[model samples]
Target: MRKLFRRQGEQRKIRDKSDLIVKSNGQRNSELEKGINFYAEYLKHLDACSSGASQLSPSDEAHTQNSDLYDGKATFATTQSELLQKLEDAYQRESNLEEKLKEKIKSYQELKEENVSLNKQIESFTTGQTKLAEKHSRDKRALVEEIVELQRRLDGLTPSLALKEAQIARLETEKDTANNQVRNVTNQLQCLQMKLDEARRDEAVISKLDLERRDEMDSLRNSLKRFEIEIEDYKEKERTFAEDLSDLKRALREAELLGKKEKAIAEKALEENSGLIKENSELCAKISLLEIEIAQLNKDNEFRKMNDINLAELAEIRESEKRSKLEVSRLQEKLKAEQERLHNTEAQFDEYRKKEEEVGQWHHRTQKELEGLQTLSSSLSNENKLLRQDKLTLSDRCEELQNKLRKKDEEFERMRDEYETVSEHYRKVLEKLELETALQHERAGEYEDLVNRVHQLSASLSRDDSSSKSSRGKRQTASSENSSGKSTGEEKVQFIVLNLADLPVR
Candidate 1:
């Protein structure tokens, strides 16, 4: 009866342990399901973040386009508008992503709470398992004591229980089956422990992934902030460029006005030059007339000398000659003044050429600026074309100016050659006048010596007359010879004066 009670108690204990193991398995399965569901939620969040990141990649591409725009490569207002739209869309998407992230974060928090609860539950389960193991050990010790007591009873009552040996063998088989069930329950508990460890490892992996995702999100936010700042800088640069364009336009207008003024000034200068040319032609005519008059005066002077003109008349003629020389000198001074005026004009032309060169340089600079502006904005293409046309016109004007300058230089060279010829002519005239003056001085000395010789011959003739008749004949012959010599000398002097007067007036 005691053995039967012990067998029943052992069977009950096995059944209870199996029930506890089954309940632990059911709890473990429920916890595993919760963990799996949490993992699924985490995976879903990860997928959402990945999708958001994928969407952000396009935004980054758009940002690159924005960078290109900043580099002055966009279709102006249209591109700006499109970029604004894209930015707004990106903002919306980011907002949506932020909301999703917030939701995901909240869910992650919930999952963490659930994980904490699950961990607490797992710990309680482990404690329950430990308690159950301790209880099982105490029960096993009691069972061992009971078995010892039963063995002692069996030894004591072996002869009497000989007829119940088959029943005892059957009880032994039941105990062996209970032992197998207990071993299976222990193996199931160990499997549950392993499953719990695996769940913990999975949770650790999920937390690590969450941290990485948070880091990525932070980086994305930083990048977005940088993009916003860059966009602002682009806006400021655009404003500055617009201001520069306006300034360029104003400068171009000013240049046009200055060009008009320069044209007027050039026209005035041309008129003045024409007048000066007319004056120079008149002066050349006057100089030619003066040279003709000088030649005439020289011929008249020679004629008067041949007619035995008085010294006072000669003095008056010399005074007239001096007046002519003074006039020639005045003409030369006027020519010099004209040359100085030409030099001043040349200096002015040089200044004008420098100004034109400066204008061309300014034009080149403006063209460069315009080209840069054109690159910055496609909307300015038409303006650039117009500017190019203006440049073409300006270039044509520059070519015309250069041609005019060449002509002016040629004219200046001709004028200089003419002036040089006139100066050489004047120098030749002055040399002739100097030679004529030296000849006149030598003729005067010869005339004075002939007059003194005439006086001496007349006095000698008078003395011969007062002395003897025979001597008077010799004196007359001598006087005749001297008179003949004097006549020859006077003819020679007249010939020389005529030759001098007849010299070509170059």
Candidate 2:
């Protein structure tokens, strides 16, 4: 009996020790698990914070389902202190993450600026066409000066060429005069043979001298007049070249300006988009906090309040008015610039018109040349006409080619617009398809979850139904036995025990 008591005491002591160890082990395990869960929740919260996603707060992280343990126990105090230290570490990590986000924003802005500069370079490349225009302007003035010099030289030379033509005419006249002189000399010599020949010979010499002087004078005057006309025509050609150059330059400048304008606008819009993204992130953060607060306040029955919002905004109105005024001023400046450009264009057009007039002068000069050539030779005039016809054909062909090019450009523009529209529409379709696919996936997951939940509910309902039926059967049996002369209270007590056995413990 003493040995049995001693063994029993030892067993009791072992049991108490084992229970204590097991309880401590279980507490350690629970604490470790809580720490692990908290860490996971912390990580999740950080992720949610980054994306501005709706999530639980730090208090939620520290909270537990076992409020009793928190209220009554100092046992987990060391572990709780460790977790608090971890939370502080997490807060530091969050602060670091915020710094990283700011750096990312700064980096993004820098990249955007770099992209804008690159785009500016691209626009400048597109505007390389303007350089040709500017060259045209310089070339115009140079060509005009060159043409004027050429006209002056032509004028100086024209007199010689005219003089030559006039000399040839004089030669013809001298030939005629020589023949007449020959006839007179022949008559004089014939008559002088019969008489004294000195007076007739002297008269023939005087007539020859007079004829030569008259012929020389006629050649010189004709030469001078022809030279003057040729010089005038050359001057006109110079003016025409200058006009063409100026027109081309103006056109190039306009194209360059347009390219820069469009590029600037695109860059501005991109900046606005970035700003909007930042604002959206801030709004989402605010919204998440509001949602959590609202959820927490939802259970309070005293929160029946309807508040009216007076959205009297001042900054937006002031900013908008400022922008409107700025826009108006910009429009006015643009209009003024446009007017200046218009005047410049008009001046260029006038120069071109002057060039056309110069071309008319060339036409007249060419006509005069043709007339002279026609008078000189029939074959030459026919060849000149052929050359004119060739020039006209070339000009017509150039006009036709230019028209075809313009049409092609317009067609290309239309095709580009259509392609852009198609691409945009395709992009929208892809986005919609992605959204639908996500929705389908979500619906599929929800369906599976619902199916699993239903199976679980069905199983629970079946178990409940079976237990209810069994309890009813036991009660009916107990009642029947009572009717056959059993203790009714005892049977009722037995039925209660059976029902108690069927129920699960909390």
Candidate 3:
């Protein structure tokens, strides 16, 4: 019954130990899951922080997602620190983008103002053209009025000139008639002089009158008196002729003076006509020049319009160029950020892989520990079963010895006392063996506990490998401890065996 109770107690302890192991494994699994979740959350936060960046390409996004998967396995502290750095970088990029946008807007506004100024210039040109047209019309009206005034003056002068010409012709005819009359009068006077000479000669020849011709001489004297009277009349006619000739000469001089006056007036009129012709030529030249100026103005207006169109096109081209440059700059910044992120992710992945390798090694070591413990427990259980069998056989031997001693009590007292002493010595040896076996079990337990502690220390050392010197020191310490543990276990085994061998032969 005691054996059964003891075995039942041992089984209960084993069950309790297994349950404790299971609980511990569950807690460890839960902690690992929590750590993994925390890392994933940190990676997600980083993704959110970088999401607003405009420069991300499809390839970059893909790389980010892949990096997230890798980073999910990273420790919490590393993910948090890296996320903060990324957030700062993203903010800086955003600020740069905003500044570029503002510059573009300013350029656009300046272009608009320039276009407005060009329109105002075109309007001014149109106003100038209108003013030129008004001036040209005023000049044309003034020229027409002057031309009409000159025509009226020329019409007024024409009749006066014709009347002067007719007066000159009539004066010439009258002068010619007076000259012919003077010539006729001079011929008459010459004939009269010749007659007088003949009369004087006849008077000399008939100085004394004959008696027979007395009656004829008295009649001839009477005829001579009549001829003298006729002579007087002829002298008076000659004097009147001279006076008429002088009058004719004075009239010719007056006519010549009038002709000179008319000639002078005609010359004045010709000069005036020449001046008017020059004025007309000048006006015509001005008209032609004004037409050419108008044509030039029209051409200039067209050129200005073309220039405005060209300016607008140039402005558009400049704006497009600016936009393209801004986009390029933004893309370059995004590419830089992506490259930096990729670099950080690669480094994180490398660290994560190293940690994973260390974890795997740790799990392998733990499995080895569990296996070793299982073997030690099984060996202990087998030793206990053998000890129980030995105890049962020794009890049976004790019962037989007591029965024989009771039968021999009348015949061998001395032999009975000697048997008692031997039994007591055997009991002492069995007690010593039991105590040694217990000590061996306790040593085995201590060895297992030391192994577990060493494994834990090694795991901690692997985790802190960032400090190369410290990890090296820890590794050296762990090696020394492991050697010491092996040596102690071996010594304990040898001690147990020696104790077993030194037992008495009784």
Best model per lDDT: 1
TM-score of each: 0.37, 0.17, 0.19
lDDT values of the candidates?
0.61, 0.51, 0.52
**TM-score-based ranking, best first?**
1, 3, 2
Residues 296-339, candidate 3, lDDT per residue (tens digit)?
64475467677764666556655755665565566556556655
User: Ten-residue segment with the worst summed lDDT in candidate 3?
Assistant: 203-212
- How well does candidate 3 score on lDDT at residue 159? 58
Cα-lDDT of candidate 1:
0.61
1 or 2, greater by lDDT: 1
Models, CA RMSD each:
80.0, 74.6, 99.9
Q: Which stretches in model 3 have alpha-carbon errors above 4 Å?
A: 1-311, 401-506
Residue pair clashes in candidate 2:
none
Residue 96 local lDDT, model 1: 62
Would you list the rank order by lDDT, best first? 1, 3, 2
